[model samples]
Target chain A: MNISSHRRTRDRVVTVLTYAAMVFVLLLPFALFVGLAVKSDLLFREHSLGDLLFSSVWRPSSGEFGFKPFIVGSVYVTLLAMLISCPICLLSAIHITQYAPTRVAKVVTTAIDILAGIPSVVYGVWGMVGVVPFVGKIAGWCGIQSNGYSILAGGIVLSIMVVPFILNILMEIYRTIPRELTEVSLSLGATRWETIRDVLNRKALPGILAAFGFGFARAFGETMAVLMVVGNVVKIPEGLFDPGYPLPALIANSFGELGSIPEIESALMFAALILLVVVLIFNATLRWLIIKAERY
Target chain B: MESNMNQGKEGRNIERPFAEGESIIRVDGLNLHAGKTHILKNINVEIPKNKLTVILGPSGCGKTTLLKCMNRLTDLTPDIKVSGNIYIGEQPVFGSKTDIVALRRKMGLLSQRPFPLPMNIYNNIAYGLKLRGKYTRAELNELVEYYLRQVNLWDEVKDRLRSPAVRLSIGQQQRLCLARGLAVNPDIILADEPTSALDPVSSEAIEKQFAALSKDYTLVMVTHVLRQARRIADYVIFMYLGEVIEMRPAQEFFDDPREEQTKKYLAGAFN
Candidate 1:
């Protein structure tokens, strides 16, 4: 009886500790959001939300802070990256899981792991050295003036960085599908490609969307690599070759210069808040879509 | 009986005299190895046309491997070496110029558990039809209904043909898988313990369907259950340790004592 009571007490203590840990994890994002909002309250009180979001003029000395250019830049670069990476990731993942020999697939998986493990700063330097010049040549061929750093360069580098992320997820999704399903399709006389197109791809569509969502979020918030190649100019980009500044770049580049200035600090905090909220919304929307897709 | 003497093995070769043009599939000296481990050893058998042939053995006896070799489903395994010839009619299964898709179309497979394709009920049947050729929507609808009714699932699922097939009960999903396989118009049906994952009533339903189907399609089934083999098998191939111990007509093989292994396996002495 004494031993039973002791066991019960230990179990209850462990349960309470786990619940406390879960609550702490659940409250972290809310705590961060509240802290950011409180710090940005001064800027919010001085400038209307619409003016702060939509106004293009961003002169910090005169207290004119506008986030429209950075917002547009983040969207353009992220979308371009996704457009380049999604097809490549999807096809390569299919090849790895469905067609490649086991040894070759293992080799390719290890290569992707190495790519994913590389530091982001290294990618930034590589982008500065290789991609910027390539983009400059393309711009020259297209009759546009560029000194290598541009949104296109940023997009190219971002796409390369996110390839491993998206491909790993896609390969895992394809692998998790039961082998029996594929054999069933084959036994039904469907060709291997037909089985992939008609059955396996359809089954993996929701997971594919989720993978793209994660890639998009990663690309949107990337700082050092994008800042290195994106030609951080304070204006809205007119085209792919033009220079622009994303939100993360803006906060990263200016945070050190705002010494003893509450207005500038609040504006930067507001940018961080916007970044967090947008990523949260994007992830939530993807979750909703995945759930809906699974229901059918 | 045109009996052939065994060359070196201890087992005797049982070569029953088959009627002319009766055998639909023949395996000659088939041997399979996964990596270095031999899975099937010198398998020689003939599956009769339009008959239910059950490959009965204990677990890991390569019964399913033998069935998979008929349709070349074993090719999916990695590092597996197969040295043998399997003939469906007069066509060689592993010929270099063989059209694998066409060969697969001639055989349908039912796995241990039901794997309804990730699609709606109607599309599950229609998918196979669509792969063969283009069909009008009306034709697709008619054929889907016909195949669903073939498996005795039409009345139960006719109301919600558009619903996802995964929503169905396990029994219904198995029936749907049958309907999907039958829609392709295969000449042979390979079932790998088709009723093992089913309840008793669903098992009976599947058994009745198989009995009905064997009149039109050749069936090669793998099962370890002696009662199930006794109940439905028209011909029995008893395998032990990757070798066929006896291949005989179901009634004769069960009644007469032939090999010691076959007798012990039949008398519930060993699995």
Candidate 2:
């Protein structure tokens, strides 16, 4: 082969090797998680397949199985996180996008960046000392059960943490709109608020909605902070203040409970599966919204 | 035109500028300064009623500034000072305590380039009406259709009134803007280089529409396009360096050009 063709072959070989390395990197954890989910033994040493998924006795000593309650608790907490975060994040995004002056937006946006950079563990600890008791008081006033480590507490803190992320992304979207459009509205005799509401908000709706979804996903898949704030009780939450077990928390909490290898793997694999699905759905929806926004 | 001119009995003759019922808009000793920059200096001209008056000048000649000042659009800016008065049909336009909104509603302003709002065709046409708080649902539909038809845009947009106004071609968007300006039902139309963005065919269409509109409404157009002015102007006001050098009937100004600047400008030797 000529030197040029030989070089092309080298480039092709490098490309294949790079892809193979990436696949090798990705496949390890994926296979581990999937294998743990399907493994029969709570301890993976002897048997490969087990019916731990359908069993009810979560006691690993007795070789009992099933994580139905844990799954329900995870879904409940994640959904609650969305309900709490979506509106607050979207409102702040609109405020920053439509109302905040340039300097104020810059300063406030930088503050949100700082917020995102704070450790999730710090949020968890802060919630333990700062947020749980306040939630308990609110729940007491509302005549709910007197537990502060409730799903509601976790969701609220998670919502606050994810708001900055959404606001930052959405500010960029608003900035992308042409200044001439706003000028046209003003020249038409529309007031500033009217211009924002009728023109800017409507134009930025899809991007704002995407921001909402992103905040929701971030709050939903959170682990350390949510686990700290969310009560690690093994039951479904009856209300905001009720004790609950999110999936990540269950994996974390139940790992110690498992005496055998199978039980630990089962919990980790189940939690990973749930999170992957949620993340995919969240991103897919956001992508669809971006496309829709561009078309209009 | 014959009745308006009078000759003085002297070795040196005198010329009269005004005619009976001809001074539709009169600006006297107008001076405008923005901070330290004096944009206009003693601008005085009486625009003829029911005529298509064209204001011609080079860039930064205060032609657009004067058009803006005609209806308080200039007042939308702050830190500006203006001396003297402007009268529209005997009413002082920028008079103290003038209702700014009311003043603007009576005049239509078409910007240099098309700016179609982020709305559908029907909504774009009805935007002004909605702001003015007039019309029921049926009435709004009727008014939108009427104005769109008047601007020759109804047939093309009737099927897609829900599509965004931005999707329209630039020429169509310009006409949509015209329709929007007309829907407000103003007495005078002010066009600031309205055809500069359009092709010759579109420019001709807009010129023809302006001619038709002049029968019902007064028009003051600011244009750099000499051919366009020569094609349709009834009255011509030439401004150089922020002052009106000459104002005359279109035939008199173009055929028998007088002031040195006007002569030079018309000859394409200078703007």
Candidate 3:
């Protein structure tokens, strides 16, 4: 074959392969979800989507299924985790970029990157052993009646796990801000903190929001660390100290036990759907915020 | 080398070699080093109050560095050490007791390219005013308009004061930066090649503004363009290779140069 013909064939093959891979990667989870939902619907033909979604009970052995408690658990745990992590990550990012000396910043960033590289299971074990007791003590001091394994413990562990992710992204965003902009503010007699508040924060607001989106998504869908500490109880948690079951934790904890129970299996699939939808909605909102900021 | 002709022309030209005025900024034996490299050497010059003093030199000649030193802007650079006595009025600028922020507030700086704060046109001007003190809504609006008018930007930006400053043309942005600097009520305006990023027409506009502004505020401008120096300078400081080579009046510096380096630079022998 001539050179041009060979090149054309090679390009066509690569393009076809790439498109196939893209479609498979994008649709695999969706296809699985549809299959699971249909199978569950057929098995439990009597139950409506409302009963599967809005009902509270989720017993598997006798074939009861409801996902509301898991949904609430996911929302509350993720919200608490984000509340704990966002400010700490943001302030640490600022401190690294603005206040810390070069050596100190480098050391802090290296430690954060190492923390980010650790496996999620390792985080789970660490939380199970270390954070549970500490949180129990804090709860005792606060006059809450509980052991360490609760929503608060889950949130505390999740916040610690997601902090490095958010901090790294935020630090990168802050670093990309042109040095000239800050210099101009400082030259105008603005203090370091004022420069950060007025100039750097304003410039990086959209990116910071995106970082929060990533942190929230990770915290929401996290399974291993949350499963270890969250006291996997399928109930609407009354307070931070109450034991709860997030969607991922519920799915993981029930998948093995629900082998003979079709209705509970379908309920688990619905829980997965909720998690997927929540992530999609959050990412979409973040994209909209960034676009709005760029428009101005 | 001193020009012998200066003696003859001293009586003829009232503003002979250097314009006479109260010296607002006096740099006494300023020397600066960044790491091991000497950035500025034995710089001594008095910037006359209410006059346009242009520091003219090619790139790497320390002209811009010298301009920054007067306002203590060089302190921001790491691994840099400076030994000098810079006095703004009676206050020593480099004294350990000096408040750097307050010192910087007394001087407004315009860089080679304009960097308007990431805000709307109105906020760009109002930022400095708001920093200094509190002002009600009507007062802020009035002052923002006042500075905008001072830079000949009021009419163009009047309708779009709420829009982002980055949307303006480069020339307009430069003028807006000038207005922002002026709004702070600084005693001196320090510019480092402020017009090099601008087109000829915009450069002319900024030069015109500087000419007008010199009657009230002491202006220190740095430029590599010899023609611009001749055009806008009331007093001239010619630096070469980290040293001040010639300090003279604008006309006198062009008409007759004392140092061979200044003569060569003026003749465009080398940039």
Candidate 4:
């Protein structure tokens, strides 16, 4: 047997093995999710799919299950978190790339990287201990008497945890701008501030929007930190101070008790399916936006 | 302080071209250092007003650095130390109280490669005028058209002023950059090999525009091409190894040729 043919056979075996492994890893979770959802739907066919998706009655004892409140809670907290994190991340990125001294920028970049690596449970503990009381005080000043655990607290905690992720991405995008472009603007009698506002920001708009999408998707799916802070009341919040339960929080809190009520388990599986669908949509949109940015 | 440094030069006859028609830019005893590498050493010359002056040198010999220094664009580079007395018109460029924005407004620069603002064709030209002061929509429109016309880009792009400037060809983008620079109405135009990236026809178009523009503005260009220097330069400064080796009228410098390095460079020995 020739050595070349022996090596070729070995290479073919390795390539086939890698492809099989990749396909298995990609499909395992999706198969499990669909199988569990179908099983739950067949086992408990009392509540219709609409009732499981849109109705807010979530009492498991009387056999009523709905996920509307969790869906709304997830959207509200995520949007508020995005609203808080986007400007802070963008401005900090701009300052680091354009205004701050090199040494200071390096220090800030290191601090942000450290923040990105911190565990979610640590953020939850910090939010429970530190930010919850601060939010309660601010709410009290606004003449709304409330406990500290609320949607605002949860959103604030989520924003703090995810800021470094968005900041690092945006800073990397801003740094890709060519030095010649800025110099050309400045040489045209533009002040430094004008150059940044008119030239740098305009050029990086699409990438900035993409960063926002990434932050939103991450915030929407966050589980542990939000679960600790948000009072899991399972209702649509009327104000920032009102307590609410998001989908991920509900799933995390109720999964251990699934054996008691089969219908609750089915409903929770459906919620997970919803989350999967929403995340898929977000990722698709993000990919399309990045391609659009590069095209022009 | 300025004259004393030049007078101490041991044996070189530094050509004083300051006797020509009203000198617009004068550099005396300019020395530039980039992190211990002496980039430009004791440079002295006068660029006359309303004439095309070419700073002729090979690559890395400090011609581009000198052009950038005139507008303080070298301040963008890190660890650069510049010591010199440079005057544009009557204003001191390196003085402590100089307003760099206003100083830059008096000069227009065309780089080697074209980079139009990441905007539409109309906005690229309108942005600079808007930064200067308020202008009515009609006034700005007329001004944009006038400037584009001056660069001969109006006929090609007049129909698609709102389209993104990056959609244009490389040659058109270069011309748009020229229009954008001229929209600010600068007194002097500094070009760092504006035609180096261009095809022959596009390069000829730019050279023709520069010749016409020299009647109204002081034009200073840097080029390593001996043919380009001879074709367009009214006054020429020949530099080699970070020092000015010769400064003379273009006709005399090309025909009679004073320095040995300039002669070798002109004979196509090596860049």
Output the number of the lDDT-best candidate: 1
CAPRI verdict (incorrect, acceptable, medium, high) for model 4: medium
Query: In model 1, which runs have C-alpha deviations exceeding 4 angstroms?
Result: A1-3, B1-17, B269-271
Question: B192-231 in candidate 2: lDDT tens per residue?
Answer: 9999999878888789899999998889999987788888
The residue ranges of model 4 lying beyond 4 angstroms of the native Cα positions read A1-50, A283-296, B1-15, B18-21, B267-271
Ordering by lDDT: 1, 4, 3, 2
Fraction of the real A/B interface contacts present in each candidate?
0.79, 0.21, 0.57, 0.66
Candidate 3 TM-score over all chains jointly: 0.89
| Per-prediction TM-score to the true structure, in the order listed | 0.96, 0.71, 0.89, 0.88
Q: Mark the regions of model 2 whose C-alpha exceeds 4 Å error after superposition.
A: A1-101, A145-147, A186-189, A251-260, A286-295, B1-113, B134-137, B188-192, B218-226, B229-271
> Clash pairs of candidate 1?
none
lDDT of 4 by residue, A46-148 (tens): 8777787788888877888778899999988898899899999999999898878678889999999899999999999999999899989998999998787
Candidate 2 chain B lowest-lDDT run of ten = B7-16
A242 Cα displacement, candidate 1 (Å): 1.2
Give a tens-digit lDDT track for model 2, residues A200-221: 7777778877777777677667
Candidate 1, residues A138-225: lDDT per residue as tens digits?
Answer: 9999999998788899999999999999999999999999998998999888888989998998899899989999999999999999
DockQ of 1: 0.74
Best model per DockQ: 1
How would you class the docking of model 1? Answer: medium
Which one wins by DockQ: 1 or 2?
1
Candidate 1 per-residue C-alpha lDDT over B1-271 given as tens digits, one digit per residue, 9 for 90 to 100: 1233232232534243356468888776788999889999988778889999989988999999888888888777778888867878888787688888898988989999999998999999998988778999999999999999999999999999999999999899999999899999999999999999999999999999999999999999999888888889999998999988778888887888588998887777434
